[model samples]
Target: MNFEKIVQERYATKTFDGKSIPQSEVEKLLEIIRYASSSFNIQPWIIKIIPDKETKDKLSPASFDQPQIKSCSHLLVFCANKNVSENIDKLEKLMIANGSDPEKAREYTNMMRDFEKGMTDEKKLAWAQRQTYIALGNAINGAKSLGFDSCPMEGFDSDAYAKILNLSSNIVPTVLCPIGYGTDKPKPKLRFPKEEVFM
Candidate 1:
């Protein structure tokens, strides 16, 4: 489908059919998310894809008992990585391995490090959380492009999710995206006028 159609038809799915999306399609959606743009190319996010009913059941209460949590085929927990400098280090190594000049890579890494140094711990987490939203945007839109439905959600307990998922302290659960075939239909497209929004 074209980009316009994807955007027009995509909605926050309320319920799903409980049928699994093809693994290949899910992988493609992951790749699309991986390619999403991020500030300084830090890519400060890790996604945990849960595809089993047992785990979904465990997560439902944490998600306010949202129907989408248990009904969806795959529940994606987008975690923001708080270790920004570590990712910058890894990116620098990748740059050099991919034929970038050593001097240029060092310069890039140093710049990222300098920028990271200016942030407090709170700022760091906030920045990482913001970057995760970019990936979340790709995820929901990408799911539609790949012939599935998705719901972008922030109605879950992050601390509970982290404990249930066994995530490290540095990985913060920022948002959720539940994907599958929608059982419910869209109501209508409601939006502000183009002029109002554009201005």
Candidate 2:
């Protein structure tokens, strides 16, 4: 399907058919994130593709009693890794793989290192979280391209969720997107016009 069509048809579907999606389809969504753009090209996202009953139970309280947390085929706990820019080796390897010349690769690596130095704890985590959301948007749109539906959600207890997911304070949870086939058509779009919201 065309990208524009996918964007137009995509919505946060609330109800999902109680059926499982193929593992390959789920991986395809993650594959989109594996190449998602980030500041400094630092891939800071880690996703826990939750399908276990006990883990799902642990997320119940964190997700504010949302049924999709337990009902959907897959509950994706998207995390942003805090320390994603510590590796000079990996960054240089990627630069060379992308066909950068020796001098250009070294120059880009230096710029990334400098950027990392100026980033504070708060700034780093905030930047990481923003990248995770961008990946979430891509995953959702990619799911739509595959004829699946998703609900992007942040209405959850972050601290509690971190504990449930066995994640440290550095790697924070930002969004929960449940993917499955939709059971009901969503209500009509009711947003103000682009001119009103954009200006």
Candidate 3:
């Protein structure tokens, strides 16, 4: 499908059919999300994919008992990684490995490190969380492009998710995305006109 159609047709699926999406399709969707743009290309995000019913059941309550949490094929916990310096280091190595000039790679990564040092812990989390939304956008649209359905959610309790997922202190849960086949039909698409939305 074209991009226009994908955006127009995709909806926040309230319920799913409880059928499993093929692992290959899931991997392709992950690739789309992985390539989401981020500030400085630091890519400060870690996605935890939950495919088991047992874990989804545990997460449902934290998600305010949302049916999407349990009925979707896979629950994606998009976490903001606060370890900016660590990712910069890894990116530097990857660049050099991919035939980038070693000096240029070091220069670029050092610049990113300097930028990272300017942020406080709270700022780091906030910035990283914003970046996760970009990935979340790709996830929702990408699911539709892949012939599936998705719901991007922010209603879950982040602290509860961090504890339940056994995530590290540096990994902060920022959003939830559930992917599956929608059992519910779409309501009318509502939006303000471009005149009201854009200057």
> What tens-digit string does per-residue lDDT give for candidate 3 at 47-158?
9999999999999999999999999999999999998999999999999999999999999999998889999999999999999999999999999999999999999999
TM-score of model number 2: 0.91
Give me the overall lDDT of model 2: 0.83
Q: Which order, best to worst by TM-score?
A: 3, 1, 2
lDDT of 1 at 42: 98
List per-prediction Cα lDDT, in the order shown.
0.96, 0.83, 0.96
RMSD of 3: 0.7
Model 1, C-alpha of 25: deviation from truth (Å): 0.9
Give the runs in model 3 whose Cα sits over 4 Å from its true position: none
Q: Per-prediction count of colliding residue pairs? A: 0, 0, 0
Question: In candidate 3, residue 159 scores what lDDT?
Answer: 95
Residue runs of model 1 more than 4 Å from their true location after superposition: none
Per the 3 Å backbone cut-off, how many clashing residue pairs does candidate 3 have?
0
Worst 10 residues of 1 by lDDT: 190-199
Winner on TM-score between 2 and 3 is 3
Candidate 2 C-alpha lDDT tens digits along 57-144 = 7898878888777777888888888876654558788779888897888888888878877989888888889989888988889889
- Candidate 1 has what TM-score? 0.98
What lDDT is reached at residue 115 by model 2?
A: 82
Expressed as tens digits, the lDDT of each residue in 14-75 for candidate 1 is 99999999899999999999999999999999999999999999999999999999999999
On a 0 to 1 TM-score scale, where does candidate 3 land against the true structure? 0.98
